[model samples]
Target: MFCPHKNSYLQLVCAVNPRIINKAVDQAMQREHFDPHTELPPAQRLESMQPSLYAPHVDITRAQLGFGRIGLRLINRALHSHDNLVQLQALHSVLDQVQISENAMFLINLQLIYRIIDLMLDQDPIIKEKVCLILSRLATYYQGRRRIMSRPVIVENLMRLIMRDRKEIRYAASYTLKTLARDRCACKIIMQNEQVVEDLLKMVKSDHTGIVVLHLATLTNLAEWDLTRALKANAFQIMLTLFENKDPRIVSGAMNCMSQLCKHDVGKVLADDYDLTFVLRRFLKSSQIEVIISATGLMCYTTLTTRSKWRAKESCNELTKLLVNLCCTPNLPLLQIRCMQVLINLCDSPDIRHHMKVYWEKKVKTINVRTHEEWDGTSETSSYGLETAHNYRTMCIEKVETIKNDFGDNAQVVNVHSYLRRIREVKEHLLQAINWKSYKN
Candidate 1:
């Protein structure tokens, strides 16, 4: 007798016999049988069905009855299966269709996603690849991305794939990490994730550009989280070193991360201990606008934080010139803010102030270039006959400048500048945010 679990596992492989696979796929497509109001089936019975057969039915049951308790029970049972093939098949089936219900099966889906991930520790390379695919699928699902990293096993498995594998599984694992970081809890887990960091550093040193670049992107995304101190420091150092990679893509990814991290105190720490300036300067000359923009952003951060140290010792006029060039882009508001804020902080000196004044005038001119109709369009309309007070909410621009000065003589100027600039830029961007011009006319 053929095993249903084995057949389900085969469903994921194109190499499997088409007839047998199609037959199993057909069974999986059948209508589900379960009730939303009823409790799940006993564990043993649910475990008896193939994941391929049970996954669809569970999803269908949940959709029809607004519950998937039976499906969850079956998934839990499959999780306990001793056969690796059976477990892999179960993982494949569970991930095939999107889960739309918030019932108990949702819990089972989370549990099963972890269980498959647990298989990454298996000694078999094939099994490890299967686990990588499972995690990738989980991360790819819009719903699943939020919860995927909550289970430490998910990150653990992805790290394992990154560390021990050389195939596409490694890339998939990194992509999964990038996805998981979209969730705040997941980002914290990655920030404190020691083993993952060690594996990532090793991957960065590998000859494979794809693996290293994607991993760096994931790391940069992780920097968005409020990470613990020691882990944050370690990650900052590793990523700073990656800025030297010859591959422009790898350099860009590393620079993207540096641009963000350099906005934090830890960024100053890295520059003090590493050759952060040289790295940024070299990458700024990249042929790609994206690479140049990222490199310039990081330079803006470094210039803000390390300016005093550099100005006291060596001339930083070239850096300021490069920043001015970067600030000229009208479309790159974030970049312009970072570069402008850095320039403003550095402008306290008379010499730098003269240079910055020109850019400020440029910005002022751009700010006022609105069409009369566009300007009048947002003018508040008075509904009442009597004088109505229009509360025009205006930004306190001087208060921000004061705060920039308030950070004190030794304040992390780059971070301070970035903080103030980010707030204003966020508001500006939101105001200019797209309602899709097609609809907003």
Candidate 2:
């Protein structure tokens, strides 16, 4: 029988009916009929009997009673309960079954959100961790995000959790913060907290790669909201140092953060730093595709500066080779595009342009000739080879065409073109002055 206090009734029944529980357990054991020679362990016997004893209370028809309503009731009771374990179980059950609509309703009921936020400060790490997870899930929806951001205390609590010594709590806090940071309102609130950036910087410096990556993601979103905070936190330097880490995830996280930071003035300064250039160059050779993509992207942004152009010219041979290899490969279209852009920037240096020209002439011509011959005449077995070669050549040509069009259409390339043109004009003016002096002498 269901009542307004159904959960409380169930709890009271379990507490007051020890004889009824024993009778149900005895019936379950008699039904199983265990052998007299074999004795079941007390723990196993209790576990086997638990379901039968609790079945009456646990079984509820969804048609007669809404599961969502029942789950909310349990959570509501658990919120005010003194037992931490019971509170955790109740919250976990509700979160596991609560739909988006139910979650929206929960947010509308401000007290529920307040209770969850209050639980975040609980002494038990498990309760705090679960609370963070619930908050993280709720933060995924816009309304839920707005609700969480509405309470400044929630953000303040999360910031403190991020700084805690416990790894699990830190991870949970970081994840929740990452989701929260995606919303502009929440991000603005987080950015206003001065300790947010400082705490993230500390996590980035941590030896644990997982913690560093989570914090990096949170910082990335925060940077999107306000880059000045990131710059003030020395995020550029932290990311540059993280670039050398052996973990691909750490490298990738650092590169992604650097990519976002590079859009700011401080990022431009960091990009032009000689040490940062050395790190980017080293990362270009990384075996991981993600590492290469992020590294090359950062390299492209760095080359936007005139000083970085000269610096890029010094690595012309290596970069040209890297570009050619990427361009020839069909799978990495985005990387190839970025590499081409970098090459276009390096073209301002005549020496680098000459090196690229020579390399392309030799390599492209040889590959084209071989592929053309293979396509023209092919045996049955050679047909497959011919097709492969044809596809390769086609991709290579398309890449070249794409690069050329990008050069024409790209605004960045237009800037590089103007810089080169200005240098040429200056050289011509000097040449004219020298010729005039010769005639006067």
Number of the top candidate by lDDT?
2
Clashing pairs for predicted structure model 1, backbone only: none
C-alpha RMSD between model 1 and the true structure: 16.3
Instruction: Give all candidate RMSDs, comma-separated.
Output: 16.3, 13.9
Model 1: per-residue Cα lDDT at residue 64: 17
lDDT of 2 at 328: 50
Tens-place lDDT digits, model 1, residues 84-169: 55665555544443333443236435566556656667765545655565555556454565556556666666776777666566
Q: In candidate 1, what residue range of length 10 has the lowest lDDT sum?
A: 388-397
Give candidate 2's whole-model lDDT: 0.63
Instruction: Encode model 2's per-residue lDDT on 1-441: one tens digit a residue.
Output: 221122333534454443344446657778566333223322223223222212233333121214556646655666678865566566666566445676556644745666788788888776788778878888777677777787888877987887764877787888888888767678888787768887788868864667787788778778877888788888888887787788887888788888889888778887776445556777778777778777877776777777876776777777777765664542433455565566656665666666656565454222211122223322111212322322221101234356667666553332223433443443333223222321353
- Return the TM-score for candidate 2, rounded to 2 decimals: 0.65
Output the lDDT of residue 434, model 2: 23
